[model samples]
Target: MLSPLGVSYLGLDDEGFAHFLRGTGAPFASVGALTFLFALLSLGRWGLRVMLSQKHPYEPWLWDHSWRHELQDQRLTQLLVSWPVSLVLLAVLAVVHWLFYSRVFSQGHVLPGALLGLVLLGFDIIIFTRVLGPTVLGTLALLRFGRMRLLLPGVPLELGSRCQVHLEARSLARMSNVKVELRRIREWAETTGCGDERLTQSVTHIEHSHTYTVDAAALHEGKALALPLELPEGGPEHSTALHASRSCHWELKLSSEVSSVHLDTTFVLPVYYVVGGHPARAS
Candidate 1:
């Protein structure tokens, strides 16, 4: 049977399906199967490492790694993973179209072929808009505002203290309604189910937050606005683990209206707890 997404499922018993999967000799099928197996093994290894680290308390380098570096790494990683997955989906679509065309042409069936062609066209539009379109738009947006930058203090933010930040932009003089918000977030992963049916998902919670508005006069002067934010007291400290399974951190979100354009951006903040003039434990 074919689903709304044009995915066809064969009605077979578990053992028969296993046999069918084992008998398949398609190159793309083999690649996908191997990739799934590799992913399963990698997840198992990562879970084992997480369990071991809990017992032996190893410090994560994320504490020392600057948020700017993390931001860059995240963007690069997204591009790397998204491009390959998008290309693979497009290839699969091509393979499915070819197979459908061959079988339907041999049977001289125009109706089924036309229906499947429409379905494939729908899938093509979805893939382009959801994957390829966002990538192109993000690249263009980066190019448009490549010169604008939000500068933060080099020293890490301590709990119950204040930190200074600024936005440097040559075009900000023409913008108005500048707003900034600092948010504290807690994140973790929860797993459900047992054995091969297990599933894991990441969760985020906003623990604390604050917002500030830049003065219109600052924009009129065409100078960078010095933004100072106060950290909340008696809250969780910044903590990150392997594969980012659990963590607490802060982010600064900025927005402004510039004539026909609206500018919005977010930056990760380095917020850590300090004790006796030294970085302390995570809460």
Candidate 2:
């Protein structure tokens, strides 16, 4: 039987549920329910913050956009992004606790394995930093390229077509030498095996590439740099059309390095023929 709230159970299974009860905390089921709820809350909070940032950005609840008054917002957006990660870590910890109670693991084994799990999640965090870093820390604090406008000769960009590209970028500080590369990259995941026992692998392929030098003169006022490049046929199979990746994708990759940090970005575009992609909306 379960509580009226449907959160905790009164009776127990002799093995799994009973064993779970005798741990450090009481009423493990209630705790588990709360953990998931907290996780959902974290997810919701971050998502709401993301939407709000685009609008109010920073605010004085009583007034408005208080963040604008200051050159920098004191609140760290990275912490907001990290709250959900804590929930993930908690969920994993609970699972580790379950593994111990289930007798599937020994006491010593659980600690190391749980630590390994945390380490892996720690690694996954770099993704958030890279993705949201530019936004959270501002454009100058991170390497960012914006408003990349590519001009192609007559037809849609295709095999052996030479073109000029222009874009604006921001960097943490000025460097003596900076280089830019434009390339087409293909990435996809493939799964092998049957039903529940399948294996998936991530694959990234660089189909074409060209490099240019961005001189310090253009860095003045974050000016757009004009680059000249030539394209090679990615393949007979790959289309010039840049489309969002479902299982596979062909992306226009723009990248560079500043100091020790690798700064790169990609735009979806058609580099071949007739592959369908979403078109830009005109204002």
Candidate 3:
């Protein structure tokens, strides 16, 4: 039947009937199919880009490895797997009717098939917006917030090497009894299995000055330190740095009574080299 969009006719032998279908059903089917295909192609392209990104592990069956990792959080895998199946089934039904049951086209089945395909297409769009859309946004947020800069002595440290850590806290006003603790990551291979090792200590008092030196070799082998600073009731502006052997997982927690507390922590590692039978900075 040819709707305003394309050609749709039950039989070419009947010119009048063919013309009518062409004017209505044909156009409607063509427009609907084009819209559906456009949406599918767009989604497919997006899926490809996500799959190829650095953070994503290459997995054809999954949209993105990060999404798969979060499957348990939002049941995204189930939806992604089922949506395509539904679309494919509806498309196959339409194709079969067009090839073998041309008479059904005039009998009104074509319109329903086209409508169903459009509906499925709409559903896919909604799924993208409600499911993948938010997931992508959240991933971006995590990337921005969870970013850590591992500074070395004018260079980058290898995965297994030991280096000094410079921990700093920024803007610590309106907080009391504030304490900072550094916990080394135990589960990751880089963290030398020392679970939650305590590496240093700092107190957010008026002076706001404290420092500790730790063996990076021991820290990398899984040893970490927890540095807790007690902030005053009114709290003072504060920042601190520490020298540690390896980079470890760290977290910040403010006291419940403390309000409007701001903290910025950074880890700085120093580089070492072997020169003239002694270890020295690369520079």
Q: How does each model score on lDDT?
A: 0.61, 0.46, 0.35
* Model 2 lDDT tens row, 1-283: 3222112221223453445445534444656776798899978766765566456422212111121111222223444544444545455556544544344233334554555556656655664565444444434433243323433333334545567655455532544444666666666677899889999987778766667665645645566456565666444345432223422233445555565555455544434432232212111
Candidate maximizing TM-score: 1
Cα error, residue 201 of model 2, in Å, equals: 3.0
Instruction: Give per-residue CA lDDT, model 1, range 172-223, as digits (tens).
Output: 5566557888887778888999999999998889877788787646645767
How much does each candidate deviate from the true structure in C-alpha RMSD? 7.2, 12.7, 19.8
lDDT of 2: 0.46
Superposing every Cα of model 1 onto the true structure, what RMSD results? 7.2
lDDT of 2 at 199: 92
Point out the higher-scoring one by TM-score: 1 or 3.
1
Give the C-alpha lDDT of model 3: 0.35
lDDT of 3 by residue, 232-279 (tens): 221100111111232222222211122322223333221122334233
Misplaced by over 4 Å in model 2 are 1-155, 170-173, 234-236, 241-252, 256-262, 274-283
Backbone clashes, candidate 2: 7
How many angstroms is residue 168 displaced in model 3 relative to the true structure, after the best TM-score fit? 7.8
- lDDT at residue 113 of model 3 (Cα atoms): 47
Q: Candidate 1: list runs displaced more than 4 Å.
A: 1-64, 67-107, 118-122, 193-199, 216-222, 235-244, 257-262
